[model samples]
Target chain A: MSTVLEMLSTPLFQRALLAALVVGISAPVVGTFLVQRRLSLLGDGIGHVALTGVALGWLVGAATGAARADAYAIPGAVLASIAGAVVIEAVRARGRTSGDLALALLFYGGIAGGVVLIGLAGGTNANLMSYLFGSLATVSSADLVATLVMSGVILAVGVGLRSALFAVSQDEEFARSTGLPVTVLNIAVAVVAALTVTVSMRVVGLLLVSALMIVPVAASQLVARSFRQTMTIAMVIGGLACVGGLLVTFTVDLAPGALIVVIAIAIYAGTAALRPLWHRAARPASTSEEARADATDDPATHRAR
Target chain B: MQLADPGSDPDPLHLHGVSVAVAGTTLLEDVSLRVHPGEAVALLGANGSGKSTLIRAALGQVPVVSGDAKLYDVSTRHHAARVAWPRIGYVPQRLSAASGVPATVLEVVLTGLLGRNRWWLRRADREQALAALEELGVADLAHRPFGILSGGQAQRVVIARALVRRPDLLILDEPLAGVDLLTQFSFAALLGRLHAEGRTIVVVLHELGPFAELLDRAVVLRAGRVIHDGDLPRDHAHPHGAHDHLHVEHALPSEPPTQRSLP
Candidate 1:
């Protein structure tokens, strides 16, 4: 505990910890919307797209060598994210039912493109592994700032457009009749989600990105009773996993991003295992007056627990 | 299904000389119908009767070739503030409340307010949302996550969400199509109450016996044209009243909404 406190005082440790916390909190919050929309795999879809963005970013900067990587990182990522989002949107517009297929195609295709680009640049899979799983120890203060700013914007969008977003998700035609500007808003949401995925890629790596984006949220929804409460709980769980991952990574010598995701999945498994007990214990006796309240309020017992 | 005789009269939403051809087949031909504001209407026909096609064209949610549905006082040529959108609140047949929709019952209802006001939902928004929920008898479900609600609850929430803005026109496509008898009756009661408030409701009615008492007027679509528009049987039980209004030449086929049945 003292060493953990000691680590917190260090600049490098503080930066990694903050980055993890920020990413952790933001992913699950956004994940709730994605999960509700049945687009949990879409995060994986965008994660692969971000890989292509990174390759493209690397390719563009490599003309002058690797020295310029930091300078071109965000712009390249942003441009690629926009392109990837447009492709997904086009497929959806064309009435493609399997968003997962589209995502898989995009993911594998982008990865191939990335691998080819790396080969052309004389880079190897070993060099790219850092981008795959992430390097939390290498997080600079600027990365922390970027994560904080992006997370703040994403969270703000979640709060302000909460109802409008929900209206679209629930009954899109009704939302249209209510004048929701569904097309524009839908596009904007995709772009924002793409952006969030792009930023998150740096923390969890392109491969494990969806776990961060989805699992924490899925776990929290299992526990939370309300929509708002679910989002809050997801954030808490995500933040905890990130902090715990960072602490573990520092203590033992494991990859920080992978450990973070590992911790998140463990949390999910833990919650699932404990749900039967919590669910049963939470149930009120049928003969009691409290049973009526338990029927609605205690949702754990509401489903087939 | 009704067909336009292709002569004499063209209803307000008339499809005069209009033949929509897609993939080398004609979908609708010379369809015409008049629908006025504050008129409780019905579009009745069997499946594939082009009822949905007509509704889409009338609302201008889709483009009609060689024909137009003109809202009174608005030119059909220019884009105007999402015309026919704010004027009508529509509820489609299916709504996905699948896992992960981040809205509550009250939040969904609040969306109805987005059209008339730009400000965030203040106290008045909450009050109106509550009132709409109360009108539907599901005010207690206001905070429930929308996706978690039962089918009956979802139906009532959709109705409440539609009525939140006090819309001039309400359009429901197959509102009672799949619901059970009990829920259907409750939905029928909601329609009656809305009609009492002087709001126009357009419901696509396939099963007429259940809703005959509450229907103010109906515009039957056969193929894509109005086959009947005039007094329908206001009371199914009696059917033999002196002033039944069913005999009128221009009386639409819907029952008079204002009249009460034999007690």
Candidate 2:
């Protein structure tokens, strides 16, 4: 507790904590929509594209000698992601392309582009490993601000895209006939997904950012009854994973991103395995007891079960 | 002003050489029909006769292979197709779809008010949705989750979604199938009322015998082509006691026409 409090007071540590909390919330909210739309792969693909942004950022910033690192690194990455989004849309409009194919194409293309660019800009004083695989041990205040701002943008867009997303996923034709802008809705979702993936890089490595966005929600789904319930559970689980990962990382001097992902997987496994067992363990002794209670006219217990 | 075409009041929907082929098979071929305002036309066809495809085409929801489907005199390709939708309400056959979707009757109905013209809906949207529910006599079920509603109840709610738009045309696809006789009569009465108000209604029905008298005209299809298009065959086609369904208290016995019956 004392160590945790001390870490909380330090500006860098505080920044990491804020970033973790915000990312935890934003990931699950956006993730729920993706899962509902059966676009979980799309999230993964976009998260992968976001990696190109990170690589692009480092390449540009390192070449510029860190004079305008923030502007070069962050904005360049975001713009690249937006461009990737546009290209994805354009490809989809051309022929027998699907969202899934488009996503995979952009993600792989981003990765290839990013790696080539990073390799071409070779001389790096900063550790490329840290950006590629994340080092929460030294998350900066600026990185935290970037995460928060991006998460906020993702959240705002998610809220606006709620109905549009729902309509498109469930019934595209009805949505179109009812005047819902299906194309615009799809583009908006892609943009937000890209933003979310871009911002979450500090807590989850470029290779693993999608897992951070997807795993908690997937794990939370084991015990959740409804989409909304799943979203809430995902957020809670994600935040807990972040907090626990941070504590474990700072204490044991481990890589926070990798540790957090392991914890997320563990949570997913535990929830999936234990929820049914817990329900079975908690059930009443006999069906006769439930029958007796119902006979007596007290309906609340029956309702509770 | 935009959902309705300004150039011509010819009919709500005019399809000419409208054919749609999915993958390789021709689903709808050279189908031409006109649905005039204040008219109630029953679309009669056997299964795979392009009944569903026809309904979808009229709403500009399906791709036309060769010809044009004009929704209020505007081709589906026109930018006004988006604007044309709000003025025409479409209730698809199945409300039992999206069984996992969590929405209340009121929430689903409120969706009708959404169109490209409006960014967001206000209290007026809810009010209109509510009024549509009231008109359909399903306002009491507004708070219930749509997934949990009875088929009859859900069908009414879906109809309300179309009716709430207050469009120039109302298109329903196989609405009466699986619905109770009482509910069917009530629904048909609502359509009768809409037709009386000068709104065009085109309904796709597999079983047309029960409500034969309710509709003013019908276009029967045989393998993606219109075989018959005229006033109902009123001259003792069945005399099967099906037409007097509203006066009876029992379920309306309905079986498809012999030629169109499933093999």
Candidate 3:
């Protein structure tokens, strides 16, 4: 606890922790929508695509002899991720049964492309590797600022479009029938999801970013009764996981990305295991609200099983 | 501002030579039909007879290969087609019981009012949703998870969703499918109320079932073409009886109407 307090007092550690907290909050906000729509792995796909963007930024920096390529990396990744999102949308829109197959192909193909591009960029710098495994120590002030701004934009959009996103995600044809511009909203969701994936890669790394996006949401779904409640709980759980993982990393020699993911997975497992206990505790109270919650809760648990 | 007032002139929906083809196989071909204002028209056919596709085509959900689908004289293909959807409320078939997300009955119905113009639900919208649910007698189930509801209860909620918009045109695809018989009568009663409000309704049904009384006309389709587009026979039509369902096969014309392109 003394060591944690000492580290928290440092400006660099504070910035890195703040960045992780931002990711913890915002990634799950967007993730709840994706998971509800059964697109949980879309974050991983976008993360892989973002790697290519990071590689391209490095190549551009090398050619221009810029002081740093990291400045261009996030934006490049955002663009590349959006492109990959559009491709996934297009494949699904084709109404083919093989669309899932196409997405899987794109998912692995993106990672392979990223590796080749990173190799061609000819940078043996540990900075590139840090993007894959995540290093809180490497989060510069500039990267922190960019992460905050980008994450803020994503959060605003996610919160603002919450209703429309829920409506469209739950029922596309019905949303369209109500004049909700289902196609545009879907594309917007894809874009926002891409943004979340790209920014979260800084905290969780490209390889494990999706775990950051999905795990807390899965845990929240087990504990919360309503859509709104689920989102709030997921955000809280994500923040806790981030803080807990960061503190553990400080005490031990471990990769921040891997440790964060492990922490999130543990939270999910813990939530699932404790769900019956939660119900049992609530059963004694037996209030109408509890009864209603119990009524709603069973089908969801059954479906999940 | 006012409840729907039906007129004979501009039909709420008109499918003129609409042909929907998916992957080189025509789902609906040369389907020309019209639902006049305040009319409760039912599209009847066996599965794969294009009843659902025809309704989908009219809503511009499916592509019209060689003809036009118009909602109240506005071409569904027009750029402004989206603006006209608010006037048309649509209810999909009842969802499967195993759907993972447990949206509240109110939440499901509230989505009916969500559109490009209104992304957020106001108190007025909430009241409107409540009123619609109340109208369908599912107001008590407003806070209940929709997935937990019985088939009949769920269908009522779906109907409530459609009625929330107070739409001039209501299109329901298989509203009675998987619904209990007792609930089917209740749904018929609900449709009767909508029809009395002078709303134009186009519903797809495998059999007339309890919906017989509310149906002003029945359009029967066979192999993607309309076989019967007028009155149902007296013997086959149900008149608000406790039991009202005719075997569609026995009721359909034995010779079958000659398949021809709509001019």
Candidate 4:
């Protein structure tokens, strides 16, 4: 308890906490739509591609003799991730092959390319481990600012395009027929999702970032009755998991990213187990009561002369 | 193949010399259809007889290989940028609830209004959505989770979603394909009401069934060619007058909308 309080007062802890909270809120906001669209693996695909960008950033910095090469990593990763998402969209539009096949190619090819690039850049195992497992405590103040601004923009965009996004996610063909700019909306969502994955990689690591994007939203879906409720609840669950994992990391020797994922999975499991009991508790009353209400409310039952 | 008949019908929907082929297989060949104002036309055919493909081509969902597909006298390719969607309402085929995201009936209906230029839904938007539900007699279901509704109720909610836009032309693809018999009666009744209100409708069906009384014309396809197009022939395949009890005229307060002439 004393150590947690002490850590909370430090600037390093403050920066990491800000990054975690921003990621916690923003990841699931975009993630709910991704899960609804059945593209939950998109985060993992983008994260793997971001690794190539991160290693490339390091190489460019080393060649230029920059003081801090890591500072260029986030932009490089974001660019690569967005490009990967666009390529996936292009492949889907081609109609030449199955969408899943294209995504699988990107998913495996990205990681393999990233590994080779990291090796060619002369990166040590420690540097690779930081991006893989995430060194949350090492987040600089600049990273904190970037995470805040990026997450804020993501949240704003999500809220602004909520209806169009929901429409496209539910039925793309129908949305297009209604003039909702289905293609543009889909590309916008993909770009935002890529941004979320890139920023979240610093806190949850590239390998486990998808868990943060999908797990909390999945848990929320078990209980939430509406889309709005599901989005709000998923964000809250992610935020809670982040805070809980951080506090635990302060007290014990554990990887924060792994702990956060474990906490999210625990929440999903608990929600799933308790869902049946909750349904029974909240079950609607008897058929007789429902029929009575329908008799009173249904105009079709009362014929007009 | 040649395009549509060179007639000056000025219909709401007109397809001229349309052909759609996938790979080496011909789905529709040399097909032309025109849906005039205040007309309810049913496209009928057996499975794989090009019933779905023809409507898909008319809606510009599938590319027309040879001819032109126009809506409100505007080419479908340029329709979106020309502010033409507000005049059209489309309800797709029924989808399973398991394959959907959880949303309230109201939220699903509100998606109809999303094609407008507004960024946020206003109070008037909510009221408009409720009024549409009320028109369909499903206002009580506004707050219910859409995934929990039965097939009949879900269909009505989807119709309400389309109707909220107040479209002059409504298109439904297999609206009663999966619902119970009782639900079909309600759908027939709703179509009757829409017809009396003078809204143009184009529906796709496997058979006339309960919709026999509401159709102005029947256009049947056999292997992508229009084999029959004229008045509906009375048949003994299904019982008629199943929806006679639900034929009450709706009490709409507003006068019939004044439709615009073809540009």
Per-model C-alpha RMSD: 8.2, 7.3, 7.3, 8.5
Q: Write the per-residue lDDT of candidate 1 for residues B1-263, one digit (tens) a residue.
A: 12223243222243344445444555666676665544567776656666676655555554567665654334232342446555566776666545663456787788777652342456779899999998887888787667666555677778787878776567787776545455677788878877666566777766454577787666555665556666553453223344335323213312221221212
Place model 3 in a CAPRI quality band.
Answer: acceptable
Please name the candidate that would achieve the greatest TM-score relative to the true structure: 3
- Model 1 TM-score (2 dp): 0.83
Q: How many clashes does the backbone of model 2 have?
A: 0
lDDT of each: 0.67, 0.70, 0.78, 0.77
Please report, as a value between 0 and 1, the fraction of native contacts recovered by candidate 4. 0.34
Q: Which residue runs of candidate 2 sit more than 4 Å off their true CA positions?
A: A56-80, A83-117, A123-133, A215-244, A252-254, A258-305, B1-10, B21-26, B93-101, B123-154, B177-186, B233-263
Worst 10 residues of 3 chain B by lDDT: B254-263
TM-score for candidate 3: 0.90
Ranking of models by TM-score: 3, 4, 1, 2
User: DockQ for all models, in order?
Assistant: 0.24, 0.18, 0.26, 0.23
| Residue A51 lDDT, candidate 2, scale 0-100 | 54
Clashing pairs in 2: none
**B117 Cα displacement, candidate 4 (Å):** 2.1
Candidate 4 chain B weakest ten by summed lDDT: B253-262
Error of 3 at B69 (Å): 0.8
